[model samples]
Target: MFSSGDLEQAKTNFPEASSRDLKGKLLLPGFIDPHSHFGMMISAIGQANVAPPPAGTVTNFSDIIVALENYRDAFGIKLSEWIFAWGYDETQLAEGKHITKIELDKAFPNNPVYLQHVSGHMGVANSVALAQGGIDENTRDPIGGRIICFDDGKTPTGLVQEISMYYFAGKAIEEFQGKKAELFPKAQEHYLSFGVTRAQDGMTDLLSMAFFRSLAAEEKLDFDLVTLHGYASLKNDDLEFKTYKNGLKVQGIKLIGDGSRQGKTAYFTQPYLTSVFGCEKDCVGFPHGPQDELNRLIGLAYEKGIQIFVHGNGDAAIDMVIRAHEEESKRLGQPLDADRRPVVVHSQFVREDQLNKYRDYGMLPSFFTNHAFFWGDVHRENLEDERAFFLEPHS
Candidate 1:
């Protein structure tokens, strides 16, 4: 973590990349980010970055609008063209609140604008954008998603969560099919610049897999990438787990147990002290889907001989995953101590009991330590100080 040329060891070890744009940036050795989803970056290619500090320069709500406006003008986007942007974090804003559609409408009166939340679990859409997404006052919340509303409950507040967010993000990506066929060179170079050679995509949909395969055929994939296909989105169980091809591999099946904690959609045992955009009194967050569905999906993967990697950000969600594993083991009539190692990704708010259960079943745990550093302050405001302080406990 020193200045330019101060990392003499790195220069000497990888002399071949000495000329690949490592300037004044601090590069940590052996600091690999496992969840750098390359497919997401390709989908967001040529879009404005509105994330804070390290990712982008947007500090507040005002910066988001300005950045999008500039991007639209620079790209010569017509009023009829949809505006897409990513990396807007309400927690990092100076206002300490989520941006509203009112502000976006004022900025772009005719264009349909959508800003993706930093967590990738929620999004804010302008009124025009909402209409185009077929969301309206009469639109009901889907089984696994919610269309956050204003006080009236019927009218949307422009913010969509979970499954709802997926729809908007998917629609936006559909327009990027032209960009997906050709791998973006900078996408790989960006990670290389950070000295990260291997990364994993926790959730990969069918379309992304196709894009990955296309890039692999052309030898465009320049580094190792492991992707876990989304279980709910899987059309078949044909993926050969842990098999690599052209620097890319389909590692396993990913199941999302719940949403992000920072987004206040993480299922928890205790309720939040404050209210989220859609949740109020006694809000302990929610699961991404029903328990039976999760169990069925787990059983299906097990039958197909595919590995499972689930995302559980809260204690309740972790409980659900542990239960599913236990049930699956019982169904197979085999000892739980077998060599099978089901992964529990983002076991963020796991309790002591949950840890014991994980050990009892030999489930592998993947923690997000960055949560304590990046979102600790926000957690404190939303959760008990002790709970916030103990996030991603190393032990």
Candidate 2:
């Protein structure tokens, strides 16, 4: 939609992944930060949509079974083949509970099912899916993840969190790879139709990043992919940090300090109003990794001069990120306000004191303000009034 001069300027400001050939299109559009998980969203375009109202009609467990059943029949899903569905939220359900192995076992005894949570941090797996992932009662939780179990604390309820859910998620992505030729164009069009020429593929694991690289090499990827390497994948020394290959770029490392606030897994200074699963009492939620590990990861990124994006929704988790930044700044003999431009993604429920620290540290607190409209009531029920009032903390 612009003249030659404007098109050239747009190329200078943004990655030219907009269209290898726009196939005779107009000028570029304004940039917007929608915080999309570009790669997975592309894959999920074909997955059964079990998201709540305005997206899907799933309101309860029975609705979930019916939706999955419809999808299974529509696709003629083979016996024991994986059945994947996205966007199920316990808070949105009538029962206000997680879909566990029991319900999934009854609905599809032979098929392996994986229901992705609305928050990408966790998911529910059927017994078949759990077995396929080799997760069971005896399986211990991964360092940065939890295997939510029943009240007995021994039997897994088939709800896996954080790093523990990688196996199933990775498998789903692998399946997407099988359909890339067909899905990639449609997926790219879906984003481009909204004038979204750029997108963030946050917290990408090693396997997914490799797959993206392969696509780039083959000239199959069409949009700018600004990726954040998952903290666990930071150990891969071969990654080309701060560089672009085709449209895919490894922008920085992402450290998931805690889970979503609505899920009651976020790390906060005060205890949650209600008790959560897997915690005995005073459930304030916990960090994905230990304190020392956080320090180590931040220090490593600092040493490499790699920008960081920390996912910290709760106040305590924000404190952890601030402390790590301070320790790293000291070791590097750099002031906190140096032009590193670190980002604190989803600074939800961030405290006023944390806001001061963020200013001093020259950090960008990317507040996802839509939570105020989407999960405001849940936050009120879970957090004190003062904390709920400060949600997103935009000036």
Q: In lDDT terms, which candidate is top?
A: 2
lDDT of 1 at 86: 85
Clashing pairs in 1: none
> Which parts of model 2 are misplaced by more than 4 Å?
1-28, 214-222
**Candidate 1, which ten residues in sequence have the lowest lDDT sum?**
27-36
- lDDT tens digits by residue: candidate 2, 87-195: 9888889998898999999989999999988778889999999999999889998887889999888899989988889898888888777675566678778777877
lDDT tens per residue, model 1, 84-186: 8988888899988888888898998899989988788899999899998899999999877899988888888899999988778887777676676554676
**lDDT of model 2, residue 23:** 72
Name the TM-score of candidate 2.
Answer: 0.88
Off by over 4 Å in 1: 1-33, 181-183, 232-237
lDDT of 1 at 175: 69
